[model samples]
Target: MQVLLASPRGFCAGVNMAIDSLELALKAFGAPIYVYHEIVHNRHVVEHFQERGVVFLEELEEAPTGSTLLFSAHGVSPEVRQKAKERDLRAIDATCPLVTKVHLEAIKYAKEGRTIVLIGHEGHDEVIGTMGEAPEAILLVESPEDVDALEIAHPEHMAYLTQTTLSVDDTSRIIARLRERFPLIAGPTKSDICYATQNRQEAVAKLSADADLTLVLGSQNSSNSQRLAELSKEHGVAAYLIDGPQDLKPEWFEGVETVLVTAGASAPETVVEAVLDYLKEHYDAKIEPRLVREENVSFPLPRELRQLASS
Candidate 1:
């Protein structure tokens, strides 16, 4: 068996920043730190922090009053922030800057009286957060079909933004549908899909063309990981999105000669290694890396963490 690894496979700048923020907060503020959600969608990352005494809470009410609370990289809505404030908890935002950019764009467009169409999955933390910016003005569209059913009051004054992690091809199709329906609709200066998501998906797409099968390393709840798996499937290749080696099924490798392995932006490199090791041990696999892109992006820690580290 041959294993092809995708370059730029795991841990994007946003995930790195979010994890680092928690580490720094622990170093500066000590144990019992509360994070609003899994800092990223990967369970391994969250479990690692749990071992270090970081408390992950889904509800603001669960967080103790006045405890230091950190938001996840997925970003949070104004209502969440207001809830935090009402709880009188000290908070630090760990939202990806790219996600923040979309939120800001929503605000700007809404203030300009433009109807905003958010292209993303419903109920996603990032979408919820972005929608909170201008709830009344923003419309959520998940697919080209949704765009067809959309009813906007002012078609001439409209704009669209997308979640950071989305299938590039699917997003493009939706955007096309939006344009066809609203000729004067505006959009972000740059595509809202972040560099990491774009690079990872591109890598998988390229690798899947050559391999017999593709394995996307990520949790089920991870949007980016799910997209990678779907991308491969769309190309008529068999793909699996597994959290780690534990989820690997021996039957998946039946008559499979080559496997392309990749992880989502939030997945860790260690999980990739574990999967590779599992394949090698079981099937005597030979590993090769498929280089699709060189990612050099890094986001700095939050200002509060920076000051603490410097001090």
Candidate 2:
């Protein structure tokens, strides 16, 4: 079997910044760091931090007063920040700058009294947070069909925003539908989808077209990871979203000549390497590096955390 490895896969700048911030918090502060949610949506990444005494909480009230709390990369609502202040907890924001940009755009459009159409999966952490910015003003739409179903309060005054991690092609279709219905809809100055998500999806889409199968290394709850797997299937290849090699089944590889292995933005590269090792041992797979694009993006740590490190 031949293994086609997708370059620009696994940890992106946002994930790297989030993980690094958490690690520095551990060293600067002590164990038992209270994080609002999993720093990033990878099982392996969360488990590794849990072993180091990080506590993941779903609500601000769950954390003890005065404890240090960090927001996950999937930025939190302003209400969450206010609650943290009320609880007297030291808060460190680990939100990706790209996600933050969407939040800001939501605030901007809401203040303009425009009916904001937010394109994202319902109940997703990032979507939830972005909606919280203007619950009264924002309407969540997931599909092009949903866009058709929208009943804008004022057709002439409307804007749209999207979750940073979304299928570029799907989002474009949804946006087209929105424009078809509301020809006057406004949008952000640039696309809301981050560069890393676009690059990884493009790599997998290109590789999966030629490979017999595609294995996406990520957890089930990971939205971007799920999209990568879905994107592969859309490209006419069978794809599986697996956390690690342990999830791999021999039966799936039957009659497969080549496999495309890629990882999501939040997935650790070590998991990818482990999957490669398994493929080599079981199928004697020969690996080939397939590069669709080059990614060289980096984000700075949250200012509070940086000061903590310096202090």
Candidate 3:
């Protein structure tokens, strides 16, 4: 068996920074560093941190007053930040810069008196945070159909923003429809979708053709990871989204000549290696590394974290 291990497959810049922040906090401040969310969507990463005394909290009240709390990469609403402040918790932001861009866009459009249509799945952490920026001014839409059904209070004063981790093709279609109805929409393209999401999907869309089956390394709740698997299946290849090697089934490899393996941005590279090793040991698979695009983006640790570190 031949394994096509994709390049740029795991741990994008934002994930790297978020994980680094957690590790640094744990090292400098000792165990029991409080985090507002999973830090990223990966179960393995969260579990690893949890074992080290990193407490993940869903509610601000759960954290003790004056505890150090880190926000997840998905970002959090300003409301959450205010509550943390009220609780006197020292909050460390780990929000990806790309997601922050969408939140800022929503704020800009809302302040201009424009109704913003956010192109993203409902309940997603990133979407929830951005919508919080201008909840009254923003409406959520998942498809072009949603665009057609929208009755904007002021059609001429409309704009759009998107979750950074969405499929480029899906967002493009929705943006097109929004343009047809609201020609003056503030954001006319899917530029809000992050580069990592677009690159990974493009790689899978291009390489899945040669593989009999494609395995995506990511958690169920990871939006970008889900898109990679769904995008592969759309290209007519069988794809499975698994958290790690343990999720791989023998049936998926039956009669499969070539297997394409890719990891989501939030997924750890160690999981990818373990999955590859499982295939190599069990099936005597040969690894073939394929890099679709090169990425060199990096975000520094949050300013607050840096200040804390210096002090």
Clashing pairs in 2: none
**lDDT of candidate model 1 versus the reference:** 0.93
TM-score of each: 0.98, 0.99, 0.97
- Writing each residue's lDDT as its tens digit, candidate 1 over 179-259 gives 999999999999999999999999988889889999999999999999999999998899999989999888998999999
The segments of candidate 1 whose C-alpha lies over 4 angstroms from its true place after superposition are none
Worst 10 residues of 3 by lDDT: 183-192
- lDDT scores in order: 0.93, 0.94, 0.91
User: Where does model 3 exceed 4 Å of error?
Assistant: 188-190, 307-311
- Model 2 has a clash total of 0
lDDT of 3 by residue, 209-304 (tens): 989999999999999999999999899999999998899889888999999999999999899999999999999999999988999999989987
Q: Which prediction has more favorable lDDT, 2 or 3?
A: 2
Can you list the residue pairs that collide in candidate 1?
none
Deviation from native of the Cα of residue 290 in model 3, angstroms: 0.8
Please tell me which predicted candidate would have the highest lDDT against the true structure. Answer: 2
lDDT ranking from best to worst? 2, 1, 3
Steric collisions counted per model: 0, 0, 0
